[model samples]
Target: MIANEIKKRVLIALLIILPILMAPVDLFLAPNYWVKSLVKCILFIGLPLILNNHYQWVSIKSMLTVTKKQLSLIALVMIATYGTIIFGYQLLERWFDFSMITVQLESSMAITKNNFWFVFFYIPLVNALVEEWFFRGFGFLTLKKFFSRRWSYFLSAIIFSLYHVAIMAHWFSPLLFTLLVIGLIGVGLFFNYINEKTGTFLTSYMVHAGANFAINTIGLYLFGMI
Candidate 1:
């Protein structure tokens, strides 16, 4: 029993630290978007799969299951998520200078007009799935087994929000950056709640995808692609 407790503690440490460490890679090391994506996949997707093999912390089969009611909730949440994001963007555009995001994406990630479509599709679909699987499936749901509901929710949410800090560094004004981080924490909590209700991260993934859809739509407009 002591051995298992020690192992759980070690796993928790890794779960908390690995993504924090990966933030630097995104911020400083990765030269382009594909490199960043590959590193993220290896760290987020690969590590979780490997750890699950040894620990059995998550049930892949159960996580995939969804009911009709859950599906309806997913749809509603997704629409609301998309609408909320788009509305927020429109409301804040005048004050926030969001066009800087487009400039940063292009200069930092090489996200040009040619590759924007691929990124647009990838962000909302594939990237969101990877995040849901990592933050919700591995981080929150798995940690909930060893921690209290509140701690699990807050730890997972805070880490999820922090993980984006490196990516958004210098992308916004200080006030906007702070606000965005707080908003992310709220979104993380909402995603956790959806996963808790549905017994799966897939529901949260759909909502995340919707949120990404809104962001990428703004990206499209900024790129003058639409």
Candidate 2:
């Protein structure tokens, strides 16, 4: 079973790695959106499908049946947490003399336009669905079986941060590393808390996806980062 989980993780890594490899070639071709679309399908859709096969799909369905109270709590927590992160980042930027992170406002701006349905669809599908399924769903559950809950959360967050480091390998900045770690830690804790509090991973999954959507849209509007 352990070996099987390891194999599953390896598969997830491959899905992530494929996009990284394809990115440059796609950029060269000028039809970069197609490459990203395919990558999102493999990483988000493929990974979740593999995970669902390993676990009973019924559990996921059950988890999604959240109460109104739980939904309200999640919304409150997400807002407070999001606010704290924004304030903290702004403070850190001033304290450390670091530049404010640039948001890719282009995506959100384009998304608001009537012509960008494709980008809008991909945002939810690839970023929220695929990424959350692999990292917060599969990765989080797998670690919990091996370690204490807190440890599992931390480890999973660390791995998530590291996995994302692949994209920033060329930049090599300590501040970026710190931000990535902080971001992943926030995501891990928030998601894990939702799972534990609600007794279902899908509760966390919905929050994760919702938070991602909000952040991407808001970030694009405020900071221009996605």
Candidate 3:
């Protein structure tokens, strides 16, 4: 029993620490976008598979399942998310220089007008899947087994938000950065709630995909592709 307890603690610690460590790779170590994506895939997707095989922390089949009710909820959430992001951008763009987002993307990731369509689709679909699997499937659901429900939700949401700070560190002003971090926390919590309802991450993934679609739409406008 004691050995099992120790093993659980160690696994939880690794879950928390690995992501914090990965932040630096996003901020500094990764030389390009593809490299970063590959590294993230290894860390988030590959590592979880290894861990799940050993610890049985989450049921892969359960995490992938989606109900008819969840499908309807997902559609509503996606539409609301899309509208909110688009409207928010329109309202905030006058005050904040969002064009720098495109500038940074081009300079850092080699993203450009030509390849943005590929990136647009990839980010909303693939990136969202990776993140939901990591943060909700592994991070929250797994942690909920060992920790109280509240701690599991809060810790997962916090780590999710902080992890993105490294990714977006240079993208905004200090005030905007602070606001975005708070917003990310809220979004993270809401994602947790969605997953908690469906016993799966697909609901949150759909909502995340919609939000990314809105952001990528804005990106298209910035690139003058629209």
Candidate 4:
């Protein structure tokens, strides 16, 4: 119970801090970019240490179980998801006469200058693994303890969507926000389902990594950002 309470408190604190850390651009360059980075360091780095030390978070081995079929399935799912999104975009464009959807993320200073190695390696491998471990692993499980399964799923999806939007609120349009939120819900469910079925964070990590990698890569190339 105490652990549950601590988990809830941590999540609530994250909820409170993330928005302020990611306020809309105070101009073109966002005056609060440094503050946002500081908050991210605290949440993504510092909070994990505290949780692992104080709450006995799951072991690394337990978090990432490797299996042949699991990895292949993850790739398949990612491909299928990307195809579906492309199809949806086409349909929406045809029906609604919309051109394309685009959002600009604040890339690292080093990455903007064609640092493909840093963007590809750091993003897909390290960042994806760490994010899925924290959000879908610890955050999802902790939320499930206090809420119904449906609510837990919904809440996690909201958090995922909100995190993305909060980071780029300056560029967020209503149409893109809707699409992004819907996409995030699907991604959240996919991760949660993988975690539940495989009973390992590794499986979810693979799926999460695949989805993020596909979308980011495709989006960048298609939108001429790469």
Tens-place lDDT digits, model 3, residues 1-226: 7866875786677668878878888777874788888888898899878977887776899889997977997999899999999999999999998778888887777788988999999998999999998998888887787788999999899999988888888888899999999999999999999889888888899999999999999999999999
Residue-level lDDT of model 1, residues 113-226, one tens digit each, is: 899999989998889999898999888888888889999999899999998998898799999999999999998999999899888989999999999999999899998988
Steric clash pairs (candidate 4)? none
How do the residues 1-226 of candidate 2 rate in per-residue lDDT, one tens digit apiece? 8775665566446435644554553334323445555665665557556656665332455544678888788777767655765666566554563322221223212233333445544665456655555565555664565457887677666665665554334332586667666777777777776676676665665566555555445445444334
Candidate 1 global lDDT? 0.87
Encode model 4's per-residue lDDT on 35-80: one tens digit a residue: 4445555666577657666755445455567678877877787677
Candidate 1's error at 75, in angstroms?
1.2
Each candidate's TM vs. the true structure? 0.96, 0.62, 0.95, 0.70
Candidate 4's TM-score: 0.70
Question: Which candidate ranks first by TM-score, i.e. highest?
Answer: 1
Worst 10 residues of 2 by lDDT: 101-110
Residue 223 alpha-carbon offset, candidate 1, angstroms: 1.3
Question: Whole-model Cα lDDT per candidate?
Answer: 0.87, 0.56, 0.87, 0.60
If candidate 4 were superposed on the true structure by all CA atoms, what would the RMSD be?
4.4
